[model samples]
Target: YADALRVAQEAAEALPIEKDAIVGANFLLGLAQIEAHTGQSKEVVKTLRQLLTIPAGEYVSLTRLKIDPVWDPIRNDPGFQKLLSEPEPETVYR
Candidate 1:
């Protein structure tokens, strides 16, 4: 899981901001899932927020976050709850 998180973080970082949602969202979602499984609640929420900043394509959506078992670990977190309640972030890029 740690290795997966590391690789995901690296892949997400390697992408240019304008192209982040195209592929980086997948890496960030993987990182968030790894963090959630490994009990990194804060990191999981933080990573999910980062995922939200992108276009929230295949890897993320309010419905997915609420229903995905992978996020159950952090489901009780206030940050996670807030994320679920709030509208999706504005899309600055394609």
Candidate 2:
């Protein structure tokens, strides 16, 4: 578990922000999942919060987040629960 977290974190960091924002954000999400699975609640929330700042982060599906089994460890966490409760942003089309 620790090794998985380390590898995911390193892969996320090594990704180029400007050229691989989407992929990097996804990697960060993977890191967060690993943290969650390992019982690192605070780290999971912090990592997820950082991922939310990336533009591609908006593409993450709230419904998917709610149902994903990988997040089960942190499912009852207040911070993680709060993140699930926040309304997904509305998209406006021209």
Candidate 3:
């Protein structure tokens, strides 16, 4: 998990913005999304919660969380279902 966060941090440095933008949000959200796909629901939930603190988000990006081939692990989880029904912060962009 620590390594995951480090990778996310490094990824942000290589991208277009600083700590509070969508690109940075991607690194964290991507990690969480991947973990969720691989049955890492606890980490996924934790990571997404962290991302929601951002003004906008990188999860649900492309609105893909609902249809993405990844996230199959939690595809049927009640929490994920609830999340889908709730409005995403970036619906306009996604």
Model 3, span 1-94: residue lDDT tens: 5676557556755762354466667776667765775666666766665565555533454266677767778988777776767765543322
lDDT of 1 by residue, 15-88 (tens): 74456555666666777888888778888878777767777756777878988888888889887898899998
Candidate achieving higher lDDT, 1 or 3:
1
- Report the C-alpha lDDT of model 2 over 38-92, residue by residue, as the tens digit: 8888888787666555564354556767887778889999988988898754532
Q: Count the backbone clashes (under 3 Å) in each candidate.
A: 0, 0, 0
lDDT leader: 1
Candidate 3 local Cα displacement, residue 19, angstroms: 3.1
Candidate 3 regions exceeding 4 Å error are: 1-23, 49-59, 90-94
| Arranged by lDDT, best first | 1, 2, 3
Structure candidate 3, residue pairs in collision: none
**Model 1: lDDT to the true structure:** 0.76
- Candidate 3 positional error at 4, Å: 6.2
Per-residue lDDT for 32 in model 2? 82
Candidates' C-alpha lDDT: 0.76, 0.75, 0.63
